[model samples]
Target: MESDYSSAKEQYAALGVDTDRAIQLLKKIPVSMHCWQGDDVGGFEHAGASLDGGGIQVTGNYPGKARSMEELRSDIEKTLSLTPGSYRLNVHANYADFSSTGFADRDALEPEHFKSWVQWSKENKVPLDFNSTLFSHPKASGLTLSSKDKGIRDFWIEHVKRCRKIGEYMGKEQGSACIHNIWIADGMKDIPVDRQGYREILASSLDDILSVKISKDYLKDSVESKVFGIGTESYVVGSHEFYMGYAVKNQMLLTIDMGHFHPTENVADKLSSVLMFVPEILLHLSRGVRWDSDHVTLFNDDMKAMAEEMVRTGKLDKIHIGTDYFDGSINRIGAWVIGQRATQKSLLRALLEPSEKLMSYENDGNYFARLALLEAEKTLPFGAVWNRYCEECSVPSDLQVIDEIMNYEKSVTALRG
Candidate 1:
């Protein structure tokens, strides 16, 4: 394997690409793994409550799903064992650890609600990122932040305020800036007579929620927009243009979820345009099939384009990549490992690109040469370098990881029943 990597290194070096540096850089880029994948996004908020609405759906009745916070953490650890490079755990507010005592409504949630998670992160050395749970609750039946009722809106606003405080606490405790992403399922099923009114209320609610200042070093705030959700096909309150304008004016990071946009839209192309106005952006990397259906990410062209765009623009540092898909139909642990590994592979391929050479060709008006080099680079020995990276990280590079996952399911998750 070492000799193969050496030979591949020589091949890449001919194109002015250093495979060793690419591996090291890929190791430094951490992909935030979403915690909800283990539990099918059925957060540990209220026992016996089904994940019915919220513009999100997890198909399949695959058993061995994590039923408790401890089990969820255990499954995540197992998944991380098979994945290469460093990573952060992304948690939703609904996943708060209140197992001992029943539950607290969203508005009354405190940092202590998530103290266990912070402690676990510290112990495991995995940094934490957070999202306010604005769906699946009774209050979220119609609207949340954009609700016409002042009381309902206030509840969500206060909940988000507390969530931001918790995000700050986690970042301070873990010694890294925790990104608090706000995504609400505030939209209408049919055409509303007052689209402007709802957006106005949403803007006001956001202002109130974000007014509670937290140091940027401790907590970075971001707002995510969606074109449409399950029951929100007609109108979505936080549309792309709405949040883009708000993010620019408020200087907040705009989060672009891969599954949130129209199917025809290439989210990779939007990164350079968004980054031109915003200092930094957050990405919710997910595969969208037909609509915003969060399918497990694959090593497809979309993934390649996203990675290539980041590399091409020289703005990899300006983006925070995070996985946001949940596939309950398959082994939950396998889903996490596969999605994360695919993302890493895409990044590795991107880093291996001969950007300097390609740019030189373009600068000399040699478009044909540039295109040829781009296409030729794809056939290079990226697989060898990826295997070498997995070896260095002490993880299985081939299908051997699948056997490990099967053993874990039989010995661990299967017994939960």
Candidate 2:
């Protein structure tokens, strides 16, 4: 229903975003967002189990019990109200097991769970986006850091196939309702492995995962269904990010998380001029100081500078703004609202400022202030300019990040067929 690049320039304009530069800087802004607590609430009870390893000391206080599916949806509805763009619900398994009492399990691929999720989405106009388990309840979920190995691969493939079957099943009855979004938490942490091995694992896992939804004939099964492949960049440099380029050729796009980069890891510098490396989704927008920290959006000038740069570079087209916010103790709904609004406002400021300095081939003293003033103005009206910017800016693609995986599978299928 929405065009990929709707009113984006106007969004930038209303917020005093660098319209000229933003227009030239980025291409489209198909919005795909992330909400930590969705249908399943208690799934993350054991958040740091994998990090702590074996002994499984569940330290955090259980704020209360996790929210129910209905409560989670209400959170989503409030999120949608403020977000007002293309969105998909990040589906944690709705069951309660160690694997994540609230997230997915082998049962996620089960007929019942699949049907329930689809029915839920269809009734509420929400789509289920898949997030693989990297960390789960300490003792409950069987997730391990090394899950990128065969077991994890097999688990993902099975789940993917079941998801496809469910979609097909639903199409038979109610047309298409569910589109899958997948982001895997597989990669070596401290283990010893070669760079090549890392690249190989990433490439292979992606190939295996996407192979699920292959239609007898390639090309996505329908307009409503597509796979979005979210590939997180490395926490360290010279690691795996460079290798992700291979995904593009495989027909997979990227989703770079803001916190993944250090201050030195200037996202604008890295992605701005580069034409080949484009991402479908962008996460961790408000996480940490530019130099370090994860899942934090405390707000800083340097971060604002980064936002201005991204908009000026006009890379917003490839961006789907999100926050990787998840704290077990805090009110999940409130956390989501705060994080989402903070990140969205930051981007809106960047989108609205004039891009004169960015577009200027030569550097001048006015560059910082030109962008800084724009940022200030938005914050001045109690961020009303930021609000206006968000309201005005056009959303990017609504294609679930999973669509890329499905598309790739169709390619794989066609090649085989």
Candidate 3:
């Protein structure tokens, strides 16, 4: 293994790339793993409250979906064990630990409601990010923040405010800014008679929610947009235009999910433009087939392009990376590991990019040579560098990791009754 890496390192050096520096640099970037994946987006807020109203639909009935916070944390621990480098946890408001008492509704939630989550983070040395739960609740059956009904709109606004407070508490406890992300399911299944009206209300509700003064030292707020969702096949209130304008005007982070756009739209192309205006960016890495926007991530052309764009931006600190996919057909823990591994590997390959020569070729209008070099890059010994990185991170450098996941499923998740 050492010999292989040594040869690869020398090869990369010939292209003005430092493999050692790239490895060390990639280790410092934290990837926040989504907690909803562990339980198919099911939360403890209500009994048997599966994913509803949200464009999201978790299809698989894989045994041992986390029934409680304890099981979920245990599963997350298993996931972290397999994935290399730094990581944080992303939790929705619905996933709030209600096990302390009987239950506390979303609007009434406080930091105390998430005591278990905080303790778990401290125990595992993991940081956390928070999301306002805008789906599956009674008020969410139709529209939430954008609902014309004053009562329903106010309810959701209060819920988001509380969610931000929880994010602040989490950030303070973890001593890192907790990314408070806002994504709502307020759209029409068909062409709405009042698209502008709904958007107006949504903007107002967002203003009310963001009016609260949460310090950036603790909470970094972001708004997420989607092109369309299951029920929102026709029009989404928080379309890319809505959130992009809001994020830019408000100087907040804009979350760009890869699967949240037209199939032909490349997320990689948006980064350079979005970064120019927004203060920072939050990335929800996901892959959808045609319309479903929550497929397990893979190291495909789309992912590679996104990673390369991020590295070329020269603003790693301004980016928050997180995986946002759920696959019920496979072991849940294995799903988490697979997505994160792809996320890490994509960035690792980008970090090892020979940008100098590639850029020079382009600047000199040597397009043919540039294309030739890029095609040649695919044949490089990237596997050697990746293997060495995994070995150092104490994870398997080969497919044996799958065997480990299988062993865990048999012993842990499969035994769940």
Candidate 4:
């Protein structure tokens, strides 16, 4: 591996790509891993609270779904052991700990409910990101924050407010700004009549939620948008345009989910445009088979493109990266490791790119040279660097992770059933 990386290092050096520097930077870039994957979005809201829709679904009855918060953390920790580089845990409000006091509904959530989570974070040395749960609740069957009914809107608004406070507490404990992301399943399954009214209500709800200003030093707010969802096919209240306008106007970080748009449209293309408006943005990486299907993220063209754009723009600091896929069809720990490594690999490849040369070709108007160089660089010894990185990180390489996963399944998850 060392000899192979030596050769690759020489090759990348010719293209002005420093392999050492790339690995160092990649080590610092944290990909926030979602907690939902451990239990297929089944929060500890109740005994058997599994994935039930607001607009999404988690298929397959894969055994060993983390039945408790302890098991979920165990699974996540195992996943992190296999995944390389820095990481943060993305947690939802529904995963609150009610050890002392039985349970608190979303509207009544307090920071104390997440105290255990913060303690877990400190023990694991993993910072956290937060999301307000807007699905699988009784009130979320129809509109939530954008509902015509004032009670429904107020409930969700209060829930989000409480979530923000929880996020702030997590950040304060961890000493890093915890990103509080808001995504609501608010829209009609069929054609809607009052789009304008719903949007107005949503905007007002957002204003109310943001009215109580929290410490920006501790918590940063982000709003996620969807083009169409399962029950929100015809129209989505918080469309990309809506959040884009709102995020920029309100100076909040806008979240762009890879699977939230039409499949044909590349989310990577929007980074350059959106960054021009918002100061910073959050990326929810996922694979969308249909509409927001939320498949396990891979190092595919879409992900690579986004990572490349992120690297090319030299905006790594301005981007908050996180994986958001929940596939219950397979081993949950394997799912997390694969997706997290895929994201890491994508960013590493982009970091190893001959971006400067490509830019120079573009500037010189040598289109053929640009395209040819781009195509030729693909065959470079990237695998060697990746393997070397894995060795350095003390984790299994791609060829080795599979065996590790199978071993884990036999020893761990198989016993859950």
Off by over 4 Å in 4: none
lDDT score, candidate 2: 0.43
- Give the alpha carbon lDDT tens digit for every residue of 190-289 in model 1: 9999999999999999998888888998999999999998899999999999999999999889999998999999999999899999989999999998
Instruction: Give candidate 3's TM-score.
Output: 0.98
TM-score of each: 0.98, 0.60, 0.98, 0.99
Relative to the true structure, how large is the alpha-carbon lDDT of every model? 0.91, 0.43, 0.91, 0.91
What local lDDT score does residue 355 receive in model 4, on the 0 to 100 scale? 83
Tens digit per residue, CA lDDT, model 2, 8-105? 44444564444445333222342334555332234433442233321112223424323444444555665565443355555543232333234445
RMSD of each: 1.1, 12.5, 1.0, 0.9
Candidate 2 Cα deviation (angstroms), residue 43: 2.9
For candidate 2, the per-residue lDDT at 369 reads 62
> Candidate 3's error at 390, in angstroms?
0.4
Q: List the residue pairs that clash in candidate 4.
A: none
Using alpha carbons, what is the TM-score of model 1?
A: 0.98
Against the hidden true structure, what lDDT does model 4 obtain?
A: 0.91
Instruction: Indicate whether candidate 1 or candidate 2 has the larger lDDT.
Output: 1
